[model samples]
Target: MTNTPQPVPASQPIPDSTAAMKSAVKWGVMGLIALAVVGALLAGLFAGKEGVYGALIGAAVGGGFILFTALGVLLTAKLPALTAGAVLLGTWLLKMILAMVVLFVLSDMDFYNKTALVLVIIMSLVVVLGAETYGVLGTKTPYVDPTPSSNVDDDE
Candidate 1:
């Protein structure tokens, strides 16, 4: 019969799962932003003066909104359930505010571009909700205890 104890290893490796996932999301968002910028530039070059300008405005506004989507996801991941909901709602509101700001700026530049601004706002709202709805609702996973408790009794 052996009662020997095993030695535990020191210096555990730091887990990078979350960091890696976040980095992947951030880079993905960045790639989309780059595409939007290029589209805006091409629109400006090929489309008429107003069309080009409107696209550039949309790209700026939409890019900011998209960036917030990633930021909100990252921030919510670091928060507790209720706090994450709060942050998600706040991020949505911020996106709305930015959309409004974009509208105001674009409005002053051109009269016919109002529709585009509205579209931007609607699209931003949809994207933010679509991306974050799951996250906000996903915090309440059922808890399961693996260890057996000592309180159970068989004699009723």
Candidate 2:
């Protein structure tokens, strides 16, 4: 119950905070791939080759769109907060524009099953985001207290 802070011995290594985030991203990507395969198989079973094509395209565009943000954050973890935020914000805007353009471009194309494409994209987006959220919330990461302790006996 005491607020007194205990010093960490140099012999004891600190836990890596980014490890949790990394694991989350890894699991998220794996989940997306798994979903893609399952979605493709089911779509193909119902809609034939067109379904498979639609599923693959949907997975690439939808899943990749969302996953790219997590990747940007991971890559910018070492950068200043403002810089990272700016980069992420910029990428997000660009991503949105590209996604819209892609969907619009494919709207009239009948090469793939539109239903299959739309369904897979929706499923992938939900499932991958859920997996990442679960991974992040389920794991624990340690952080340091930035404020200095009031202990007068502590060595400078």
Clashing pairs in 1: none
Candidate 1 least-lDDT 10 residues: 138-147
Per-candidate TM-scores read: 0.54, 0.84
Go through the candidates in order and give each one's C-alpha lDDT. 0.56, 0.85
- Per-residue lDDT over 1-156 for candidate 1, one digit per residue giving the tens place of the 0 to 100 score: 433333334574433324543553555455545544555455546555554455556655765676676677676776688998888898899888877876666555653344443444355444434444444343343244434557966554
Error of 2 at 151 (Å): 6.2
- Model 2: worst 10 consecutive residues (lDDT sum): 146-155
The sequence of per-residue lDDT tens digits that candidate 2 reaches over residues 11-90 is: 96565656667867888899899989999999999999999989998998888888888888888888999999999999
Indicate which candidate wins on TM-score.
2
Candidate 1 whole-model C-alpha lDDT, 0 to 1: 0.56
